[model samples]
Target: MTPIFRRLLLVVFACGLPLMAVRAADPAPPPPAFQEGKEYGKLTTPMPPMVAGKPEVIEFFSYNCPHCHDLEPTAQEWLKRKPNDVQFIRVPVSFNPSWEVTSRAYYVAESLGVLEKMHRPLFEAIHRDKRSLASEDEVAALFVENGVDEAAFRKAYKSFQTETQMRRANQLVQRYGVRGVPMLVVNGQYDVRSPRMFEVVDFLLAR
Candidate 1:
């Protein structure tokens, strides 16, 4: 063979070796159960009061949760790919009294029909923008600046509806036995938490 042709074949084989190995290799097996605890379920299913027919992907997260903020895109992409098949729900938990601001802020965003608009920005307010979204006034200002009418936001922030939603959040947290933010409950039954969180979900979905 010509020198150039021989060199080209060598380069092609080198590039294809890894691809061939990958295709020939068996995938890694799932990890053994470890994070499984008292409330954890095996082959679990979501609870009722759930919207029927739609599979639910509930994210139990707080605005102050840096991990949740980081995973937002992956979670968002998951939702987008299955919009019609899955119902995505965000449950904000108060890791402390200080985190209560996050719960209020979430509903306030929902009320304004801006969860999509403010979700990441709210995360940024704490993680990136270095802003305090810890108060109704501050959050309201954010809404106003973002073109959500301040008066409307203020009214909703103080609204009984928002308060009711907050109470509901507490109840759901208790029901799911969720102790941390950014935990995902698939169909309200199986909770994905700690080390294997996303991995567990991938396993559950694969099944």
Candidate 2:
């Protein structure tokens, strides 16, 4: 080849070396840490999230369940760092009459706009303090102690709206196939069962 032609060839090869190095340096993405039918199970039919345009993370728990109580701290820690795009919800499961009472209490607090204030106390009452909140009188007393008016607490405790929410909670428990407490469902698609559940949740959210 002529000197000009050889110079042109050298220029093209020099330009191509950096491009080839970049291609070789690019790393492949790591495989997913969790797996289907192992750490988590996908719903046969995925349900749409209650809140539109945002991912939902639901915790199906019961005040009467010791395991649920044990998970409270970890759940709260995860909530503190949960994605801003996530809409978290807690559904109190009622598998028996006693559980139904606490479920009603949860909805009552929700209706009165005191759920955040009462959630931890209720859990502590049942699990830590060994207090029994199995009756309306007992639960109402606790509400009163928390600065809620006795009359208003009683009214909301037995209100139709609270009952409706309790029913909805039950429906969600059934729909999600939640057979146990301290269960986490991601965007109504996967039911997480691993100990590293929040990790699985982060994985699903990234997906």
Candidate 3:
């Protein structure tokens, strides 16, 4: 074969082979199961926690919300395996005046250093046991039963710090534009709302 002719034939064969391979190749894999703005959303104004250098995972919840109660177990389990760099914060939202009492109760427990002991039990008391813990007195009684001093519980429930935290939580809800309970905010930027909430958070963290 002439040199020029052989060169042109080889080039044509190489180009044709690629086209054939392309035709035989499998289809592209389906898109990811999670879709931005559908399963989750970006916060226009991210309310990242003041904790420096750590990615924040905030759970916007309300004690009165049954969905939050349902999510408590799943959240606790996810915490066991969460990345070390991520700091999880649970913000009790006050949707209205009626919810303010429960919001206060959460911070109160936190202030008295009883949150670790009282968190899940409070959920069980209200949800599983069908107890009406909607008022300050009712909530305080539950705390007292949990071994916290009744007076200390009452003082903390109405303390300046607890009130401030409640106000800040409400402001954050408005800032994050969180419309519902049991919503997970990853690094204060991404709003995740799915049963696979922690999965989405882990994906964001990895990214």
Give per-model CA RMSD: 12.2, 3.6, 3.0
TM-score of each predicted structure versus truth:
0.74, 0.85, 0.85
- Evaluate residue 203 in candidate 2 and report its C-alpha lDDT on the 0 to 100 scale: 89
How many angstroms is residue 101 displaced in model 3 relative to the true structure, after the best TM-score fit? 1.1
lDDT of 2 by residue, 28-129 (tens): 888679999899999988999999889999999998899888888888899999988899999999999988989999998888899899898899999889
lDDT of each: 0.76, 0.88, 0.83
Candidate 1 collision pairs: 46-187, 61-182
Counted clashes in each candidate structure:
2, 0, 0
Please identify which of the two predictions, 1 or 2, would achieve the higher TM-score against the true structure: 2
Q: How do all the candidates rank in terms of TM-score, highest first?
A: 3, 2, 1
User: Once superposed on the true structure, which residue ranges of model 2 sit more than 4 Å away at CA?
Assistant: 1-29
On the 0 to 100 scale, the lDDT of residue 174 in model 3 is: 84
TM-score of candidate 3 to 2 decimals: 0.85
Residue range 1-207, candidate 3, lDDT tens digits: 899988877887877764234555788999876778777778787665659778888888987889998878788898999878778888888888757887888898889888998888788887789898878888888998889999999888878898789889888888888788888888777888667887888877777
Local accuracy of candidate 1 as per-residue lDDT tens digits, 82-133: 6476677888998787689778888988988988887777888899988887
lDDT at 179, model 2:
88
